[model samples]
Target: MAPPAQSPESDLTLPIRPGDKPPVPLPTRPTMIRGFTLACPVCGTRGLFRRWVNMVERCPTCHLRFERIEGHWLGSLSINTVVSAVTLLALVTVAMVVTHADPPIPLLLGVCSAVAVVLPVLLFPFTRTIWSAVDLLSRPLAPGEVDPRYDPQELAALAAERAERDRAGDGSGSGLSDPGPRTRRSDEPRPPRSSRPHDR
Candidate 1:
């Protein structure tokens, strides 16, 4: 049998049509970086984190999972490490350039070590959020994406239908036929209407 018609406001269960494209183009490295800075994949919005160092459950606007998969942030850690190393190297280079000589070896090593250790902690959360947005943009929707809540009316209708079916002797069909008490037909009732005058 064909699937039952969905309520008008209910979510679409079928796949999006082939020709229907997203309004924005698929994300690239630059776009992904921008998403990370904005804290949302689709639109650049602030407040991506609900608490300090903790990602929001989902993007406020796009609803993309902030942490798409467990351990996905490890990629961000790698990126952070590379960036921090590059930054320290550049700073050391700039210092050597300005002074026309390298700093003392011990001093240079201490500075580099301090930066390398501290930089990752400072950049870690931002990198992770950005990585997640990029990953979400690159992926196809997963099976059975659903909103957590349903319309009140639809829920009420379903409840009423279930209750009516339960009240009927057999709930095999639509339950529209009113099965009288003791499985008798309403047309076969012999009691005078006056005896149930209060029902009016």
Candidate 2:
């Protein structure tokens, strides 16, 4: 069957060209934060999750893998540990300052233990998500670096082919030509643009 006609505003899937280097990683704090919010190391328009807690198979905007590998989330556990520890310490400090009363030694120890245990469980998922965001933002963008969810070799090959075509002057067009500002369709309320760091 013939393909459907594409609207000017339709999402464009640009082929990675050979010789074209992977996007340069953003260096500044703002850029890094933007990457995290965007859930894209490159551009930030992509949504990272299909649903709460379930990462999308691939980035809707950049096509990067949401979960780069099986068991990759183990790193997130470590992140959670650190975040929980920090939070517990801050909370305890605040509690001590606010109470100003010396609690029994046993009571203080019990409180600390309970906070440590409960905090990790409460914060694990959040920390894991944040870690994923951090990883997406900070990873280097070498030409052959593949999105972990996809075959790096295949993507590299594809990029090489595109570079070859571009060098040869095959007129398949360059990156997505700006389609102008998007307008809302009649049936749907436009989703609010996210202000998250990765959403740059």
Candidate 3:
């Protein structure tokens, strides 16, 4: 079947080419916080999920692809499992402490079973976002992974850094606002002098 016609804006939202850097640097604290809220870790733009179990393929604002790599969802599953297990453990511990004299075995079992069934589902979206943030931090963006046009701040920074380099005239300049392109060395290797030079 033929695909629907794409608008110019939609065309611009293409995934960054492999090995390309993301438009802006990923902030650790903010990303984690966003993940907890089930928002896009890169842009913090909300509305990623259409339903509790369904997540959009990419960030609506920044166009950052949620699944950055193959088998990325595995990380989310691991996170969900850990969180669910921990929650169950805490609940069991609290129940044991509260009803020390006669721990209701049947009730505890039922509660644990319910939690085992429900908690993972409830945490599904959250785990996905959290894993995205974690993976982003662990595996830095590659080239062409995310478009830079969406990030004005980083673009401005890059422009300023280039201007600084131009002003320095020796390819020596520091990134003013954020981590950016490496400064080129002032002393570049020159071609060897000709051995047969003579017309003096």
- Give a tens-digit lDDT track for model 1, residues 78-184: 88888998899898998798778856778788988899888887887778766765565566334222122222233445788898878774646666776766755
Per-residue lDDT tens digits of candidate 3, residues 1-200? 99899888867677767865444456789879998998877778899999999999988888888887789899899989999999999998999889984679999999999999999999999999989989887776654566666454466668999998788875454445556787767797766887996798
Provide backbone clash counts, one per model. Answer: 0, 14, 9
Model 3 clash pairs are 16-144, 16-145, 17-144, 19-142, 19-143, 20-142, 20-143, 20-144, 21-143
Top TM-score: which candidate number? 3
* Candidate 1 local distance difference test against the native: 0.65
Candidate with better TM-score, 2 vs 3: 3
List the candidates ranked by lDDT, beginning with the highest.
Answer: 3, 1, 2
Candidates arranged by TM-score, highest first:
3, 1, 2
Q: Provide the overall lDDT of each model, using Cα atoms, as 2-decimal numbers.
A: 0.65, 0.62, 0.82
Ten contiguous residues with the weakest lDDT in model 2: 144-153
In model 1, the runs with Cα more than 4 Å from the true position are 1-34, 99-101, 143-200
